[model samples]
Target: MTMPFRLTVLSLAVAATLAGCNRDKADETTPPPAASAGTGAVVTPADAAAPMAFESKTAFAEVSLTLPVAIKAQPDLHARLYAAAVRDLREFSEGAQADRTEAGGDEGLGAYDKSIEITPGAETGKLFSLVRTDSEYTGGAHPNSSFAAILWDKALKREVAAADLFTRTGDLSALDIALCAAINAEKKKRDPQAETVSLTGSDMWKCPRAALVPFVLAQGTRPGKAGGLVFLIGPYLVGPYVEGSYEVTVPQSAFRSLLAPAYADEFAGEPKPEHAGA
Candidate 1:
């Protein structure tokens, strides 16, 4: 069955080392193409300027990673995020290979696939946000997709965890309540029969806590101001996998008081119309 795979941010130095090791392995496994006669430059068949930072194909698996131009513009952010994605892809590829070997090629397994894309989000003041969506199928009954949020601090030139934006690192209860309400609203819209449950409820349909969910900053009509937060809730969190994922948005006014003093002003105005309750 499909399952969630969490992605964590890694240090730039560590990512660089891991990338170097992977490069060495690739060189050993695949030989380079011949160079042009007149220019004396290597001519690779694949487009060198493609957005894909990494790609691999084998009998067991096919993996690829793509980063947006906005992300690539920030060298430090790009290196750390790319490194983490590459590491996950390698782990998945290795595990698939091992499983294939154990099965002895009798199970009629198809080649597993994984694709990760980093899309640019809103840029509010000193904080810029990006969303990473991962889709994979490793011999599962069906494919699974998950999301992660990357908050980059332009002033500090480093990545910021969502928890760091608040005073209390534990849980933002106010934000949690707002998220629950927003999700329930979306549920009712999708399925009129779907019951709206509270966080205190014990049923599987109960709303998930905001602190545990991934979120990206939403862009508003006003320039350099955040519309609000768009919490990314995966399947099975509130409903069955067949229902798919949910993107519930909580407006800035909903939990503005919960934000840390430093980030209070960063969020203002209403979320763009298109992403109001998405």
Candidate 2:
């Protein structure tokens, strides 16, 4: 609900909101916010089903969220969506306000831009995910950035937890291991001479198991009927911040035994082994 990670620092937050982050890099890449679908696109009942809106008193941060416009819209649709949007905006407002406080007088506290989008892949809107990103520079030499994602089953009107995608909680444990292996493998392929990655140890290990659930949720854990459930890690989560966060998608077949009834039919699409490599 409140954002899953702090864009200001690199921590387990990528996996589930690490408590600490260091070094505010000047040129971190920020994902572009989603734009209006505009009035020109063909309209359908589904389109009318989920209407998105935003509110911002200043240019610092804005929230883009979906709400039910029809009287017959699902019972709690508007409430749920609005609640999610508000949570994000609150986090943004708090972060910006904190930066303003640091300004010593609240003047030109640098720029903070936070954006959100509900419908992705240009889908029919029946199934969508929330994509939120923030790029902020609060008087620092550079900016801090991070992206967070949470999938919503429009039809079900509930978040699709990482555990929800799999058959059981333990299945996620297996997935955590697979994800780490996949991420480290990605690091290796990108730079054969790159440092070894591990999330289990501090000094040299890449990440911690504690970050697994939160990281998965923040990564916008979503199911691909044709592919597999995908985990989009932000820059620096599993590697150096310079390396950037990335998607470590696995094939549906990789977890065929663990697929939930919802996505048990999926059988294609595995991220290219080298896809996450630089």
Candidate 3:
């Protein structure tokens, strides 16, 4: 009985192989690869998930000041102000990168990989950004978008204030570390008992998809010499992991000469003009 059953199985296998061979020979045409369901795009997941990394090792020149001799004479204050500006810009850009990572920004090249620069001018500041400009929608909307865009400032002091976010350390880049720390601090301030918000979604705690960090410093007048002002900087993230935000403050006082106006906006929803390139 066992031998008969084995023979029957072998015969069936041979018949199936012969049938497949016959079908292949009968097919005179080969179909093209199927397009994406919604996009009709031919690219595959491997094409979209390619790794991307950016770095700037060379430091751009110091920010050119538009202030008169009086403001320029205060070297210490000038240095501080310039440093603050660099720090703020670095933090802002890092937050942008983090947002992409949280949202799996690589879904499109336009939103994921980009560069933003800050240039100081005679009066106002300048911003420049370079990124993949392609965008497409599946709902039969705009297709085959712009290839690239060159955004520039019309009335700024310079083109962009340049700084180095890349560091030799293996850990997070300077900007990334600064943003993460700042956001962590802000959350602690809000809820002392909460845990470090991870990249998971939960009640009372969902991973924040959009987060921002703001740092503002100021100088004040003193009786004899200009005293240092306040040093306020913190980070906050908002997304699917967490609903609220967090902050960390490094409060200290320095000479008034060590102050410069650092303009950095820390909002989650607003689109930045840096990449817009007007």
- The lDDT values for all models are 0.79, 0.51, 0.31
The residue-by-residue lDDT of candidate 2 on 1-278, one tens digit each, is 22223653554335233222423443234434444458556544333433456667554444344432431244344445555666777787778767666766446443465555443321123444444554544445555666565555656666676566567546455555666676777777778887766656576346435235332221122334334444567666676677876656555455667767774543344433333222
| Ten-residue stretch with the least lDDT total in model 3 | 225-234
lDDT digits (tens) for residues 113-203 of candidate 1: 9999999888888888899999999765788899999888877777778888777756588888888889888898999898787888987
What's model 1's overall lDDT? 0.79
Q: Each candidate's TM vs. the true structure? A: 0.79, 0.58, 0.21
Q: Estimate, for each residue in 1-278, the C-alpha lDDT of model 3 and write its tens digit.
A: 01245877787777677767888575433334655637765644333222122233212211111222322322333343345434543554465566557766546444222232222211112222222222222223223222221222223322222121112232323333333444455556566765665444354443332112222211112222111111122112332223322222221221111222232211112112221110
> Which is superior by TM-score, 1 or 2?
1
Between candidates 1 and 3, the TM-score winner:
1
TM-score computed on alpha carbons, candidate 1: 0.79
lDDT of 3 at 244: 26
The all-Cα superposition gives candidate 2 an RMSD in Å to the true structure of 17.8
Candidate 1 scores a C-alpha RMSD against the true structure in Å of 10.3
All candidates in order of TM-score, best leading? 1, 2, 3
Among all windows of ten consecutive residues in candidate 1, which has the lowest summed lDDT?
Answer: 1-10
